[model samples]
Target: MNVTICVGSSCHLKGSPKVIKRLEYLIAQHHLEDQIELSGSFCMDQCSLGSSGVCVQVDHVVHSVTPSTVDSFFQEYILGGLAS
Candidate 1:
């Protein structure tokens, strides 16, 4: 999966930078660099909610996400038992 984080002005202020760093570290630590691709993104038009959140994209499907809920999102969806 490739995780694209919106780093627009709003997102930056909301704390996407920290999320990016945390995810990067996790990817590296888990040796998921090959399984995942993390990148900075422009506004996905969810700026109304601003930076207080994150987003996860698998293939082309995008999910509105937040830092606090990322763990469950990953565990239940990304790394969950369901096959894509």
Candidate 2:
């Protein structure tokens, strides 16, 4: 699966960087670095919703993400798929 994280100006100011790092670490922990393609996006137009925070794209589907729920997002979308 491919994961695209938004770290644009708006997202950076909100805590997107931390989210990215967390995902990176998770990928490493689960040995998903090879299966998961991770990249940074400029923006996803969700910033207007207060911090907009971050966006995560899995398998071509883009989901509006935030720092608060990023862990669940990864567990449910990224790692969950691998387990199943």
TM-score of each: 0.72, 0.80
Give the C-alpha lDDT of model 2.
0.79
lDDT of 2 by residue, 1-84 (tens): 778887778778778788899889888998888999889989777667534556667777777667778889898988887778
Model 1 scores a C-alpha lDDT of 0.67
Q: Top model by TM-score, which number?
A: 2
When summed lDDT is taken over every stretch of 10 residues in candidate 1, the lowest stretch is 49-58
Per-residue accuracy of model 1 over 6-74 as CA lDDT, tens digit each: 877777776777767776776677677878877888877877544346654656766656666666666
